[model samples]
Target: MTTAFSLAPLFRSSVGFDRFNDLFESAARNDSASGYPPYNVEKLAEDKYRIVIAVAGFQEQELDLQVEKGVLTVAGGKRDNGAQNQEKDNVTYLHQGIAERAFKLSFRLADHIEVRNAGLANGLLTIDLLRQIPEEAKAKRIPINGQQVLEREGS
Candidate 1:
């Protein structure tokens, strides 16, 4: 049994968090569709992250990664191997466990987060992410100018 949560109270106290509320609602609705293609997210450094996904039977050409408007998407599909089609009549599986169906997964990225690189090795797809904060956005000391001005007599 899953317990449902309401975001009504959060909306009352939080300002400018509409996107977060929407994201939470969407996640709750799609919780049932998130089991395939297990993955792990790790923080490598202060602003660096890595996402590793298990893709045992998938090839490099069959996987796709895209980032748009602060959203990252990863998709995979199985291509028809020539041998599998030719030997379909003679092949039989008593128990098939590995999933070959197409799947799409999406992740919401914070501002300034970028996908640095991606690679597939030993059935694991690794995606590197970097959070690059702009120079203006970084914290800096503000110079305070001290000056005194004399007011003129009432005219």
Candidate 2:
């Protein structure tokens, strides 16, 4: 399929959300996966996250990491195991218990989010993400505005 999913409508329908709108729209085209491998996304901190993927047989050269617009894409392809070699390598199969396959995964990030790093160790691919809190999104005192405003400091 040319496209699988989209997050654009949710963003484009609102005002003052242009930056976020563009981000989500870009996510729709990041990486399209057919589900060979599996992965998980975990929140590490208030603004930090991690995506752990199970890339058991894929080597570093066979993999790619990219951030397009505001989306994160990870892809890998293994050396092809053709049907001719399958029968020759196996004696007999009672019930196939394991599956080894290549896969690609995609992640949509919030505005101002950045990938801190990525590494492969212990058969797992770890990608770290950090999102910077915008000044408008931070909490601050109201300054006691309106009728609630306090008297003059000098008084």
Candidate 3:
């Protein structure tokens, strides 16, 4: 059994949050597609983050990583090699539990977030991200000009 929920009420009184609401809806819809490759997201510091994915049985050449339009994409699949195919054809498995199928995963990044580095080690793919807020976008103190002028005029 499944229960459906509406996000309309959450954004009824908010502005400029349509994309945020869409993200929630998209995640809810993609819950069933989250299986296969397991992953972990960790915050290392105030502006640093790490994403680790288990990509066992996948080679470096078989995996791909890309970031575009505020989205990070990770994809993996076994390449077709003549020698590798011939070796696999002669082997038989009773259980065949290790999954080596093609998989793709996407993550929506917040504004100013950038992918810094990526590496594959010991069947794990690690991606580092950094968030850089622009100086103009950051909060700053504003001088009170009208208050001082009003005091001088009244004096």
- Candidate 1 lDDT, 1-155, residue by residue in tens: 99997764333211222467666565556655466788877778888888888988888999999988777889999777788767864768898788767888777777778899999999999999888989999999967677645567893
What is the C-alpha lDDT profile of model 2 across 1-155, one tens digit per residue? 59766554333212222466455654444444434466666777777877788887667777899999766778786555588458647767787644545565666566677898999987788988887778998788856545845577898
What are the lDDT scores of the predictions, listed in order?
0.76, 0.66, 0.78
TM-score of every model? 0.75, 0.58, 0.78
Poorest lDDT segment (10 consecutive residues) of candidate 2: 9-18
Error of 2 at 128 (Å): 0.6
lDDT of 2: 0.66
Among all candidates shown, the one with the greatest TM-score: 3
Model number with the top lDDT? 3
Candidate 1: which stretches are off by over 4 Å?
Answer: 1-23, 143-155
TM-score of 1: 0.75
Task: Give the TM-score (vs. native) of candidate 2.
Answer: 0.58
> Any idea what lDDT model 1 has?
0.76
